[model samples]
Each structure stands twice: as C-alpha cells, then as structure tokens.
Target: MKKEWVFGTVIGISLVLGACGAASTSDDYDPNEAGAEDIEPDMAGFVMDQDENRILVVTPMDEETAKEGRAMWVSEAPEGLWIGKQVEVWVDGAIAESFPEQATAERVQELEMSEVEGADLKASEALSTALSEADRENILAVELLAFDQQADQWTVKLKERGDSQGEWKTIVKDEK
Candidate 1:
C-alpha cells in the first residue's frame, strides 16, 4: 500500500508539471492578427511641394536618381508640413494611376531627420539652390548629403536629367 501511494503521488505531480509547461508554451504563441499597431504606411517619401490642401511626395528610385521614382499627390495634407520634409503616409483607399498619382491621406506622420541638428540650411533651400544651378530644368533629384553647422554650409547632391553620375555641391547657408 505504501508503494502504490508513492507512485500515485508522483504521477499526479508529473501531470501537473506537464500541464503547466504546455500552458506556458501556448501563452507565448502569437496568431499575428492585424491590429492598429500592425498597420503600415502605404507610401513614404520626401515632400516636393505643398499647397493648402495637398502635397506632392516623391520617392527616389536610387541614391542617384528620382526620375523613375514614384510620385504621389496626398490630398488633405496635414498642417505644419513643408517642402523637403520626409513623411510616411497611409492612404485611405486605392491610389489613382496617373503621373504624380493621387490619393487621400488617411494619416500622415513626419519622419525624423537623420542628421539635421543645429543645421542652418533647410531641405527646401538646398533644393532651390540645386534647381537654380541646374537651370531649373533636367534636374532629376536633389539629395542632402550633410550639414556643417560650424561652417554654415550644406552639401547637396544633384542628379541631372540623363546623367548617370550625380554631382555634389556645397551651399552656404543664407542669412535670411
């Protein structure tokens, strides 16, 4: 009778431990269901231009060229958006297929600039300088390379139309 009772107690403990282990493993499992936090933006790019109601966004195809990059018009643009600001946009529905495609922005969020601390030159200023240098035509893209706050200079790279190589230009910050 002593032997049977010990064996029965051991079995019960084993069963309890097994059930706990199973429960823990199951609790760690995730179904990966889509939630609000799981939602991703449909498009992300730099703001090329903006109006009261809309903003144009352009994504560069590569580091050197934006000629073939996708362009989209985001309607109902959020306030505080300015030219050359990077943003992520969630579209309300399907995008219209057109040059500078149109879509309604369900949500828009500004992306943090990587290295713009204490910079005097803004992205729009850099773009304007590049455009003027390129004769305001045949300019594929303008990319900000770096900003030197001590020197008050901005290094901007310009990709001209039909050019395989991009040229880097240094722009002194305007005191206006």
Candidate 2:
C-alpha cells in the first residue's frame, strides 16, 4: 500500500513539473517570429524621401550605379519613418515597374539601427551633405559608406534634368 502511494505521488510531481516547463518556454516567445502566420517582408531599403501619403525607398546595387538598384514608392508608410532611416516594407499587391516603382505598403517596420563602429556623423546628416554636394535635379539613391577620423564618406547617386542615367558622386562630411 505504501509503495503504491509513493509511486503515485512521484508521478503527480513529474506531471506538474512538465506542465510548468512547457508554460515557461511558450511565454519566452520572440517578437520577430511571433507565430507561423507572420509573413516576411517583400522589400527592405533606406527611406530616401517621404510625404503625407507615400515614401520612397532605394536599394543600392553593387555595380556602382543607381540604375540597377531598385527604387519603390511605398504608400501607407507608418509614422516615425524619416529620410535615411532603414525600413522593411510588405507589399499588398502587384508592384508597378516605373522608374520609382509604386506599391501599397501592407505593413512597414522600422528596423533598429546598429551602432556604426568608429562613426560620429549621423546618417541623415550624411545624406543631406551628399545631396547638397551633388547639386543635381533628382536623387536616385544615397548610401552611407565608411567613417574616417576627419569625415564620413557617402555615395550619392543623382540624375540631371533630361538625363537617362544617374551619376554616382562621393561626398565627405566633417565630423561634428
């Protein structure tokens, strides 16, 4: 009789412990991978321009030209997004393949900016300085490069009026 009682008690304790462990693990969920229904973003890039209704995002290509890079006009952009800020956008439907492609932003997530090693200049400031230096009619893309002790380097791709191709120009901004 005593043996039976001890065995039952041990089984009950084991079940309780298993239940507690499962609950704890479930509570420690990741926000990025919230559930199986979470969809991946269709595109990711830097916010080059924004207005009340839409935002322009430009992805830089490795060919040293902005012509190959993809640019998208994402509507329904969430608040708190600014120029030079990185973001991931989920497109709701088909993307129109214009110079700056158009798509409705189903969901826009502002990506956390990682700390740039040995950098003193802000991304927005870098972009602004590059734009001023380029002095072109239109901007294709602005990319933050490296930072030396004296200045931060940026590659600005610009297009002049009536030009078919954009030009890539390097601009350096002094550290403040």
Candidate 3:
C-alpha cells in the first residue's frame, strides 16, 4: 500500500511535469500583446491607467456609435457627458517627450465635430485629473446617448470610431 502511494505520487508528478513541458512558454511573452487587437483608432488610442503605469486594454463592446463608445479609464462615478475638448491623442502607446513638441494640456474647446457626439463637457473637466497626453489623444470622444447606466469600462467596435479631423465627415449613407 505504501509502495502504491509512492508510485502514484511519482506518476502524478511526472504527468504534471510532462504537461508543463508540453505547453509552450516564451520568456518574452508579453501580456500587452493583446492590446493591438482591441482598439482601432484613426491615430494613437486610449489606455487604462493605474498610477504611473498605463496599459492598452481591450473593451468588451462589439459595435461603436458616434454618440456612444468605450472608455479605458474607470472613475468611481460617471465622468459626466464628455464633449468637445482639445486633447493630445496618441496611438502606439507613446510617452511624454519633445521632438515636434510635447502636447501640453491644450484645451480642445472645439472639436472639428464629427459623427462623434459633441457635448458641453470639457475634456479636462470630464476626464480624471492629471492625465497623460497619450490618454487624451487615445480617446475618441465622449458619448451623448444613454451612457449614464453603463458601468465604467471600455469597448471595441466591429469598426473604429470613424471621424474627420473634428470635421463632420460623412459616415455610411443609405444606399438607395
């Protein structure tokens, strides 16, 4: 009986070890690799920030609209109808720097205004305090529709938030 127990333990350990060995492991495996598949913005896109560390996380939503869309940063309470505000957006997870110039806290009081909903809320006012330029630029826009009930989270669309340089660019027109 003791021998059987010992043998069983050995076999179990071997099977576990074999399973682990069979599974592929990359020392360079990146948790952030999935970020690329989530957000599809015209420029650089949004990020979920936690203190000094910010990462591009995917949203759960399938369809996106001009008035309603996803968000990365989660606040305790609804940030309140986000609208026109000058924001410094980025796409591939850029950080603060200088070359052309750092995008300081510029107030985008007026969005060129796309199918993207325009609201009275300022970007600075709607967003959390002290946001990185990457976060601001990454944001597509705030929704004007029924978003009050949505739990704070981001969503990806079958299509990206289409826009035209703050201009009201034409989306899909009904084909007659």
Candidate 4:
C-alpha cells in the first residue's frame, strides 16, 4: 500500500509539470518564423472601411498575383486618408490562432491610382496631397511598388533616409 501511494503521487506531479511545459512552449512561440501562418501584406488593395480600420487586400503569387476577397483590421490609420481609396498594410499576425483568420495591421499606406495632368496629380502636388506637411519633410524618395486595380490606385513606397546617408525610414503615401 505504501509503494502504490508513492507511485500515484509521482505520477500526479509529473503530469502537472508536463502540462505547464506545454503551455509555456506555446506562449513563447515566435510568429515571424518561416513556417508560421502569419500573412505577409506584400500585395496592394483598397480601403474597405476607415471607421473600422480595415483594408481589402489580396495575397498575390509571383505568377498568379491575385488571391482576391480578403480584408483585415489595421492597427493605425495613415494620416490624411479615407476609405474607398487604394492602400497597403503591414499585418502583424492573425487576431487568433484559429480558422478563417483575421489580420491586424501594423502599418497602413495609401496609394495613388489615377493620374491627371493637374496640380493634384503631379508628384510634387501629389506628395503634398498624399502626406501631411511633417511626413513630406522627412521623405527622401518614393518608389512605385505596384498597381492595384480593385483599389483603383498605384501603390507607392516612400523612404526617408535618416540623415541623407545610411539609415532610412520608409513611409507609404497615396494620391487621392
């Protein structure tokens, strides 16, 4: 009877420890790993709703280039921007590790789709229109990333080289 009681106690303690170890493993999991299910918002799309901070985007394959019908929540809204325009976003990960995943945006960028020979369409004019006065001053260069038709805008990536030298900060801009 003594041996049996000792064995049972050992088993119970081992089970408790094992359960704790399993929980810790999940808590320490990194979302940025290669096999992680985190979505990469490398493709361009449109703003679905500004109030909700959501963007409608598609994950494009190198060849296929169209995943279609996907929307995610943004963490912050880019300034001077509204809904119904083309925008790009950087998502952190799924809101929950479950099926039919929902994404949370880390950054949001507006894009310019239509171009007309006017003050609003010109790069200098468009830049001012796209970004606030503070943002424009920090930007060094702008590069056109891709054209998103659904958003009806041209996706552009901007960079502000920190000191006219090595380090740079990237900013996203859109033309209304």
lDDT of 4 by residue, 1-176 (tens): 99999999999999999988883447756656777776555435544333444433322222244222333445445555454456667666656433223567666666665654322233434333333322433322333344444454434444333345222222323344
Model 4, residue 25: displacement in angstroms? 22
Model 4 error, position 99 (Å): 9.6
lDDT of 3: 0.32
Output the lDDT of residue 76, model 2: 81
Q: What stretches of model 4 exceed 4 Å from their correct place?
A: 1-43, 52-67, 95-101, 117-176
Cα-based lDDT at residue 18, candidate 1: 92
Candidates sorted by lDDT, best first: 2, 1, 4, 3
- lDDT per model, in order? 0.66, 0.67, 0.32, 0.46
TM-score of 3: 0.21
Backbone clash total, candidate 4:
4
- Off-target runs (Cα >4 Å) in candidate 1 are 1-35, 64-67, 115-118, 121-140, 148-151, 158-176
| Each candidate structure's count of clashing pairs | 0, 0, 10, 4
Q: What tens-digit string does per-residue lDDT give for candidate 1 at 1-176? A: 99999999999999999988883335444334454234577888766666787977777447554345667889987777456667888888889998668999988878776546776556555554544455433324455456767877776664433445455455656343
Model 2 worst lDDT window (10 residues): 154-163
Error (Å) of candidate 3 at residue 139 is 9.0
Q: How many steric clashes does model 3 contain? A: 10
Give the number of the best model, judged by TM-score: 2
Question: Using lDDT as the measure, which candidate wins?
Answer: 2
Cα lDDT of candidate 4 equals 0.46
Model 2, span 1-176: residue lDDT tens: 99999999999999999988883446555445746346678888777777776988777555455344678889987776466667788898899988778999888877776665666666555665665456444645544344455445544444332245645666665466
